[model samples]
Target: MSEMVIETSNLTRRYGKKISVNNLNLHVPKGSIFGFLGPNGAGKTTTIRMLLGLIRPTSGQIRIFNQTLPKHRMQILRRTGSLVESPSYYGHLSGYENLDVIARLLKVPSKRIDEVLGIVRLTSAAKQSVKGYSLGMKQRLGIAAALLGNPDLLILDEPTNGLDPAGIHEIRALIKELPAQYGITVVVSSHLLGEIDQMATHVGIIERGHLLFQDAIEKLREQNSPKLLLQVDKPLEAKRLLQRAGLQVSMDGDILQMPNQGLAATEDVNRRLIQAGISVYRITEQSRSLEDIFLDFVDKEGSL
Candidate 1:
């Protein structure tokens, strides 16, 4: 197993009467873009706050870079960079100037500013006032600030929120390249599945204060199990016949659908249907969309 860059054990937090984050175990592997996914108010921000040591967990522990939080907070923070929600910046300051301000605060050398600006593709616009920059440019600038200290890990919470489609794509592409390009492990939080789908190598899905799923993106994709989609000449008859043979079946208009019980079962069904004079026009394996699987997890389960 790869070393975990971030791990939490039964991490919980509450505000007043509401339990914002229930017992949650989140694991983020080193050098992987781990997508912290959930809907709004699903404890993503609250969890992030705890991870950054901005807020204390009511109970449980957070381990980053293999050292416990609070105990090694300063040491861990030095190797980590983050942007939570919208980044704060002085509109009058140029992009370079804004980063220069952060660089000085971090005690980073001035030369490092140019490198991070280039990494975020904002070197050309480095001299322009931030107020004149588009939302995407400003976002990249924020990322550049986070990168100023040359962090080993980057945590971004909703970095793509309220952006145009083009802007979202820009951030997504940048994030996808960070792990290999810079050897940085990223733990990005988002309520948007499509954003996470395009960039992350692994995923942790949270809902109503509980972690419902955590695994490689491919594994989550696997959760959408393939089904045998059959376009039969007599759809109703095929469904009835299949069900009678102890096969659970469903119909989609003129199609018959059943669990894809591997090749042997599929062949047996085909043979049985053929023997019954039923015409099987087509046989295909279809899996549900990621959105469908995601919705199923969030709506029906406490964990997966």
Candidate 2:
């Protein structure tokens, strides 16, 4: 089993009279890209700020790298790099100079500055003033600064906020390479579900400050309940044949959901439908998506 890089036990945070984060328990394993997903105003930023010790939690505990946060903040931060919301850069200075300043603040070696600039593919534009750089270039500069410490873990909040499709793809590829090539743990938050589905090894989904689910991406995909969607020429005959086979099948217009049964049994039902003068157009395994599952759970809990 991999080590637990981050753990929160009933983590809670509040602002004045409103509770911004409520009982968020997150476990992010070492060497995995954990996708932190939530709707806007869902307290994702609040949770991140707490993790970095930038803000104090009203209740609960947070542990990073096996050390309690806020108390050993300096210790934890030494091995962590983060980019939250927007990238900060000195417009008047060149990209190289911007990173040079951060390197000095972190007291990193002078050679390390060049290494990170190369890592984010910003070396070519390092001499250009940041004021004339594109949005993507500025974002890359922020990433360069984050890698300055060669931290074991990188926390990025909406890293692709203002990038074009090509820029987004470049960032995605870089993020995917971090864990495998450099042995770094990545915690990324994004509103794009499709991108998260493609990039994450594990996922933690939250809604309205409550943690809805946390598990491996593959495990979540496997948890989808099995159903069959079929298109047939003779919908009526197909329905009748399935019912006669002792299968509880229902038809909605032209589509049908095969009854819960073994895979072999389901195949047999399909064969019967075809043989009963029904021309089967298509047969597909139906599964609920992450978004679908998230909404269903939220609605179910809200009704209680």
Error of 2 at 107 (Å): 0.8
- Tens-digit lDDT track for model 1 on 139-212? 99999999999999999999999999999989988998899999999989998888889899999999999999
Clashing pairs in 2: none
Each prediction's TM-score against the native? Answer: 0.92, 0.91
Worst 10 residues of 1 by lDDT: 295-304
TM-score (C-alpha) between model 1 and the true structure: 0.92
Best by lDDT: 1
Deviation of model 1 at 116, angstroms: 0.3
Q: After superposing candidate 1, which stretches have Cα over 4 Å from the reference?
A: 240-248, 251-254, 261-272, 281-285, 302-304
Q: Native-vs-model 1 lDDT? A: 0.92
Model 2 regions more than 4 Å off: 224-226, 259-267, 279-289, 294-304
In angstroms, the error of model 2 at 144 is 1.0
Deviation (Å) of 300 in candidate 1: 1.0
